[model samples]
Target: MASFQIIIIGTGIAGLATAISLSQKTQHQILILESSSVLTEAGAGIQCSAAASRVLSSWALREEFEAVATCPDFTEIRRYEDDELIGLIPANVNDYSTRLRGFPHWLVHRVDYQKILADAATTRGVKIDFGQKVVAIDVDNVEVTLASGRSLRADLIIGADGIHSRTRRSIPALKDVVPRRTENYCYRALIPREEMLKNPVTATLIDNQSQQAWAGQFKHIISYPIAKGKFYNLVMTVPDHGDAPLGQYNEPGDVSEMRQVFKDFNETVQAVLDTIDSCAKWVLADLPPLPTWSSPNGRVILVGDACHAMAPHAASGAATSLEDAEVLGLCIATCNGIADLPRAAKDYEHLRRPRCERIQEISRENATTFALPDGPMQEARDQIWRAQKAMLEKQLQEDTPLAIPAEDMAQQFPHPALVQWLVGHDIIEEARTHLATRKEIHNIL
Candidate 1:
């Protein structure tokens, strides 16, 4: 294998994970360029589905991850008005073992997850340069110009700088591609477990280490325990009322307005809100699937939010980013020399684009489903959840396998098949198979 220099822009989850993956799988010198002077303790909660867990497991960060993460037993969807249980998605490892083969769903603080990835990447010999803002990219020459007026040349440049990526803008083909506002804003808060334990109504939430989503008209709330159950993460998504400009991602939220918006919600929800002294409001936005995720020369490629940003409804954004890193690493590791880099980049995009596009669509669809108004559509959606819940209860009571209609199961949020496709997928194996087929075809030609 030929030794090559690979520069990854940004040190977010995607960038760090890519560095770690590449360092582990290939002999390339992986360098990460972070625009920030130092990594700040920012971000709220992130739900890591089995798909991401699989990737993390391969990176040998399970012990480190589990130390700071919470493994939710299950995720429950409930009615916002009365707190009625609408549906349940089992997330216990024991349940997954019998179903999806032991991959677990994790609730983690984003800061903790990033630290783990950063540590792992550094431990594997990946060098990270801070305050290196990439201002321009010369794809033909495989070079990136930093804001400091210095230029660095590499065999490959990965634009993982995120939604407002300068590297992405430098690509002529992606000049018109931009992030579209979803017209939804979210309030994020973290409540100490000690506060929640003081109230009997809220105490039950922390008892089982389960995730809960309160679904209602034009809004929804998803909450889970993170930081090893020391704090509870809460995110309230509502219709955007133009409180903040699209350019500003996070801002101070008005606690009074937040409480008023959900005042009609059940007592349990109010109890959770009462504990919030302050919160951050984030405007939710995502990019449309680009015409392509790579430059025409294939030397500059986009990963994670830079290429396929999506709404948080599906909780697969981070997971998909991890999948990108895993697949891209596997694809690049197949190259025997610099001449194979372009083909490797093309293979990575071909293997990743469709899945990412589909997940983006699903996430938008989920936003609609989660905020359906009180009407026949909402009623029908609720009915589907009720039927599924009843079926599961009966199956548990009888200890027998009952026929579950595919259509009915498909209507449930986070549909079983979708979960299987997202979580049960083996990206590494898929990438290897893809590379092998391409090699065989090339030989035949």
Candidate 2:
């Protein structure tokens, strides 16, 4: 009999959530190793979409989430240079999420959201050892060597360490692993609502209640409300068309550097530059599609950002990560705990790989859909999108800002049922099919 239990080697959102969900399947001791002292977020805002909301509701944290998260009024897409409105995604003061997923899509500050998740896990008896960085590990023995000189072992090890995952390297099942930067450089900052309100340029770009996106050649700038409309989150992305050196995201830039990156953006967008106190420039990174998400020996597994780091265009990263958690959670529950850890790990890899790969493809293709290069084709595409949107808006309410409110949504859409399945039941069937004959799907892609 193995004295080793479930050892999770990171305390990120994906790691913490894994511990919480797995804790339910048995009384097996769970240990979390987090490198950072204070568990906080690296970014400002995140759009937790329907796919994510469904899983969240299952944890029965809706009321608690509602208390901290903001349901924005819109995600109106537009042209970057001219600021021409192209598509309006309604996000108003309604239960639109409930329409899509019997719940809602929430845009919350990263730290605030992480706190919600962290608190829930700790309250449920997950033992999180913070301030402990993982230095190395011996996968065969299922032992983890911590930076603090403590050694821990487990029957199962989870590599939720993130994109630069240490455990991902040890898995013979997924070698030739390299995280490529997607040529998207993002500059992000926060603004006080009062300051944003005073500027005509900024005001035109966004109100306190809605989200705004202006698409350009190979890029876009988007802003939205957070912290109960007290502050706004803004992100501007541009084209490099070439990859950056590994770890360039580690550097922070001042406001001057940010302006230079988006120099050709509209004047309204420039208003953000003046009011911006500071900013961070990030070179987004992600892994190529893998044939399997499991170790050949079956003691280690990958999840969340490590497995599927899609482009942020569709706002699907967080959503997909939660989906990863749900699939792995159900797998453990069915297997009867860490006692069946190997089987559960294999099941998790099979269920998630294809779904995650599809999402990755769609996300990569999606970024360019709105921001085509400047030329004749760009103008024509913009005009067609606007014409189509105008045709659709005829049936909607005008007071509904430029973005689609959940109420304005087509009642027959499939978003709601998906949501229902996400929150109300186990998606064991879908997971099984995804990983079904996983070898064929891996080669096909």
Candidate 3:
């Protein structure tokens, strides 16, 4: 029998989710390597959309999230100038029972989510090794060389490293791929729930279970409850085209500048801004949709930001990565621990490239609309978003920006239902037909 061990680089949600999803399906051994001497995560919060929650709920994390996560009862998008509630995003039964169980978003601490994912992976028999940096991946032999000079040979290698993934750049096939920085800077702050509740402007049920997203001419801010209602997390987006590589938090940010970013706004927003502590700025960056993330050889491939990275427009980056994990796992489940590995990698890219590319486009488009200048475009967009709210609430088919034929979209994500089906049903014939004209591009020698 061929060896069936899988090696994963990184320990974030993407890495753990892959190990967990694949552990139950095959007898394959799984190893996850993280570079940190100890766990170190960004000081921020992550919002799990309905689609993302759907994947997690199926993984049986629904109750755990409910216990520690602050469920948002409503999602409100408002205008920056006057703070008029643009429209409300409703959380209904289908969204609830299958995904978040009724909440559109969950305000979760980064550390909390990481712990839960790590624990889940361990329970599934995944061997996790910390403090090992993956310096090189020999796709030809399915081996990985760590920074410490340890050699690891596996049936497959998954690079879940972040935006500046060393494994991605190491692959000659992905040599020309470049990550693009969006013309936006994200600033975040965390405050005690009691402090926010004490502010008269946000004192009202703002302390309750709900999320607030406000759009302005050139900036945006998101605030929601977190830490089991003990603290609140806020992230504000401001326009900045300056040169910065995801700047670190060291020098303090001017409070005036932070306030001015949303000065023409609501009293509640103004009040919240007054409480921000400095040293916050993340230059948003994303990779263009690649036709393939697989390597020139079949034994190695990229996952998470190492592959189809998207802007945090819909908070879909991690969600999509987890999806990629599941599908990749399914492909490897067929591995007989032999030379069948090449065929498995080819099939994996064939099934994934189209979908990840589609999601990449959707995520980019969302960024454009969200940052639309204040003018006719904004007016038209407001109308469209309101309609989306209605459709999502009334069970009507959402009217898309353009009428794309179902066949065309089939190359990637054809519909929201497909996302759910990716976790459930997939007809093999459709996949075979789709990749019919496709050759083994990733493994093309």
Candidate 4:
């Protein structure tokens, strides 16, 4: 019954970023549909690594981001049992930004970040339809049918929906592709900064402005400051039995029971848990790698978690999604007309798939590292961290740039290498080069 040049499903960060990016390049009419009646964030904190920060800055959101995000001085890894420091990675925001011409790694509440993207989307005149549940889609026809029986067509349809993407099922090839349990569940909690400062156990962490993590047998806890240190976000991940009913990602977990899981943790970790008045339990799910991210016809495409959902171990989910949007926008803008949509869609998938797959694999591996039970493997990992820390400290003493490319880093620091691979990438520039090469090839052909 309605039409547009582009229809983006889901209004999360990815969807909004896509709309904004596309609108900036061309006057394509963009519509974003959300199943929820309201635009809100149920998630907790999110990391905006250097790559994502650069994307946001390019969108003229630097001021907005600085207001909502905190740049921690460093990240430390400690043993969960006795809290012995294993490693410390200097996260000097200023130094990195200056050397790389990129923004610092930032921590922010999810809601605040979403607000920034949503505001940017609206300013770009992207139409957003809330409470519109897409029940079915026809990728070949570039059409989607709403639960209310309304059908809409677009020149191109983008599935930016989250992990449980309904739009993903529209592609016949992905109909059977469902997200499976990663056997990890998490308790996400946010503590007010004032409250944290009041407690002696949490005060030192807050005072240092350091992001910290404790690795134990079969579990880990990550804590950091967000909202410019107005609040501290803590995420605790542990193995679960996949007990939640089908179609359910989380259930209300009792605070006492949740605290008990970390009962044997170090005093600081347990103390932090004790202060948690409430928390949300989330079961981590990930999609097995798909053979393709787009339909054969290329009229419909998947972006963000729809195509490469992964465990949150590497903390690159949002960054990858943002990169996907940047690439997708670049592809669409290269199109000469509606007739070129299919080719452009194919280009987007080609440019994005490999990197996304690598991210998914690394994130899964990182989850294993975090939840490794006490054993030789865990001890080896800790030793690697200690060696890397010593190397980093030597570099600092020698007054050298702390930019160690993943390939150049010690083998035990694979997760950091994955992270370095992510933050060091310039997706926009990559997209430009890719499209430019394609343009030459097209002309020759």
Candidate 5:
């Protein structure tokens, strides 16, 4: 293997994770560019399923992550109007060894998780330059021009910039790839655990350390505890009626308006909303599946939200980004020199694109299923949930595994098989297998 210069744009989860993973797998000189002068404390809570958690564990971040993250015991789904229990999924149970791939499902604050990755990457000899916004990308020359008119050349460039990626726009081949607004907006707020505990209705949530979701007509709410359970994170997604401006992705939300939208929700949800002093409204948008994730020469490539930004309905945005970082690193490690960079980039895209595209589709489907109005379809969905709940309860009481028909399982929200496939996937092993097969083919040829 030969050493090369690698530049990763942005310092979000994808950028930082790529830096760390590449540092561990390859001998390349890695640099991360951040547009912000300082690491801003933005974003709300994020879920880290076993798929991403396994990658973090490989990077030796488990202890630090566990210290700041909350492992919810289970997840509960309920009706919006009367708080009728619809379904229950065990998230972090001892007996259910296969749950979450035997790794704890982490509910963590985004800021804390990013800091951990940043620190780990720095410790591994990766350098991050702040306030170095990428203004343009020269795919042919394998270089980037910063906003300050500084040109930096590298052997390869990874565009982890984000949804409004300048790097993606710089590539002529990706001109057709654009983000489309989903007409869905989310109001995010955090309530203090102490405040919640003061109210008995909300105290149960804090005590259980469980994730809760309320499904309603054209809207839904999901809440979980983060920051070591000291703060509770709330996300309310509803139809977007020009709440935020076209260009603005995130802005201050009106508390009164947020409360009114979910005012008809059950008492517990209302209590949670009432505890919020302020909230931020964010517009939901997603990109169509791109024809390619790399330039013609493959010196430049996209990762994370830069190429595959999806609706947050599935709560797998960050996890998928982490998977991208891991898979990219593993693929790049197979390259012997600069000439092999193109093949490595192609392999990264081949392994990642289908999975990401499928997840994107699932996220969009969830947005509809989670907010069904009172209708026959809504009733049918609720009936599936009720059946699933009964089956889960029966399994607990009988202490035995009951064979569930694949079709029956498919009907449940969050689809058990889908959850397992999402969280239990070993990206590392798959990358290794892919590389091994490619090597054998090359030898035979």
Candidate 6:
């Protein structure tokens, strides 16, 4: 009998979710490797849309997630120059249990979410090894060599490393694939909740429990509350003027430099900026859609950002990875032994590629729209948002049949649709159906 041993690279959301989901269906010894001496995630916020929530909830993480995440009631968009309200997209979770089958939209800190996933995975018997950098991989043989020259073998190897994944290069068939800089650098900051609440200017902003985005010439900023309102997460994306291959992904940034970038922004935005003491900076990079994410033997495969590194505009970067983890985990569950893994891996690629690629394209488009300069095109985009906002308010008034005042209309606008294509997808059920058909075909053969 083949050994049901699995080795996963990285300890991020993708790796942990994969281990947890796979352990649910079968008893397998899973090992996760991390290169860092200490496990830490960047200080930033991540939005978990309804679709991702469904996947996590299925894993029995709903209660834990709700404890640390804030379910925003609405997300507002404004012009950076004058703070003109252009759109107010209400959360689809407004009716909680009715829409998306009770799935929620969550805003959480990256570090907190990582800990939750890691804790869940460990409770299921998944072993995690820190300070172990994988230096080489034999895809066909399902073997990995660490920097220390120690060799380990498994029935399967999953590459869950991020955009600059070394595991991605280990596939012998891929030689030209590399992460390309998008010329966009992201600056991140975390504001202490107590200090923010103490200031009258910042207190009202966070009191409403909403996610806000401000768009400007060639840049944008998104801010929201995480850790049950313990901290405010802020991310600002601007065009990078520095040379490529900075030799590192993250660097220290000064608060004064960041403030100057948005010096012309509205008073509210400026007020929030003054509170930031320091920021972390990183250039956003993504890889082109690879022809395949599996090795020739199919015993080794790539998941998450390792294969579909996308711009963060669509807010689907981590969510898509969760979808991948859920589906790939289900597909692997169909494997009766190591011999069946190749077919399962092939099926995973077949089902995942199209969906992930579409999201990748959408992310780029969203980024382009969000970063448009002050021009006719930007004006047109703003006009569309205004029209949608008006229509949504009208619908809200009609549905409620109440004489709402104009001042209250801002809070009464009907919820707008999120990326409809991604919001309600049932990836788990789809994977199960795919596996059922595969079994049928095998029986007939």
Please name the candidate that would achieve the greatest lDDT relative to the true structure.
Answer: 5
Q: What residue pairs clash in candidate 3, if any at all?
A: 96-101, 96-102, 354-412
lDDT (tens digit, per residue) of candidate 5 on 1-445: 5688999999988999999989988889999999999776566888887777888888889899989988886678999999888978767754352443646788999899889999999999999999998999999999999989999999999999998898998788896677888868899998888898989998888776789989999999988999887888988999988646544655899999999999889888888887889999888998999988998888998999999999998888888899999889888887777888788888999899988988888888888998999999999998887887787787777876534323221332466677666676777788777877884234110
All candidates' lDDT scores? 0.83, 0.69, 0.68, 0.80, 0.84, 0.80
Worst 10-residue lDDT window for candidate 2 reads: 407-416
- The backbone clash count of each candidate, in order, is 0, 9, 3, 0, 0, 0
Q: Tens digits of per-residue lDDT for model 4 on 331-414?
A: 877766666767887778888888888777777777778768998998888988898788767776787765656432222334
Pairs in clash, predicted candidate 4: none
Model 2 Cα lDDT, one tens digit per residue, 1-445: 3233777878777887777666654555788888888795866878776566667777777777788787876577766676667775554345454543455778788888788888888888788888889887777877889887988878778888888888787776665688877867677787877887788877654454668888777778878877777678887777755644565653576688678777777776777778888887777767899777767656787887877766676676777777777778666555533446666677777667766776676566656765688898777766766665675466354434333333311221113232233232334446655545444223110
Q: Residue 180 of candidate 3: its Cα lDDT?
A: 80
TM-score winner between 1 and 5, please give it: 5
TM-score of each: 0.94, 0.85, 0.84, 0.94, 0.95, 0.92
**Prediction 2 global C-alpha lDDT:** 0.69
Question: Could you give me the TM-score of model 1 versus the true structure?
Answer: 0.94
Native RMSD of candidate 3 (Å) = 5.6
lDDT of 1 by residue, 1-445 (tens): 5678999999988899899988988888989999899875456889988789888998898888888888886788999999999987767624542355346778899999988999899999999999888888888888999899999999889988887887888788888777888869899999888998999988888665889999988999999988887888998999987757885666889999999999888999999999988899888989988888888777788899999989999898889999999998887777777777778788889999988988888888888888899999999988877776676666666755433323221333566666667666777778777777873333210
Q: Give the number of the best model, judged by TM-score.
A: 5
Model 5 misplaced stretches (Cα beyond 4 Å): 41-43, 95-100, 401-412, 440-445
CA error at residue 57 for candidate 3, angstroms: 2.7
Ranking by TM-score: 5, 1, 4, 6, 2, 3
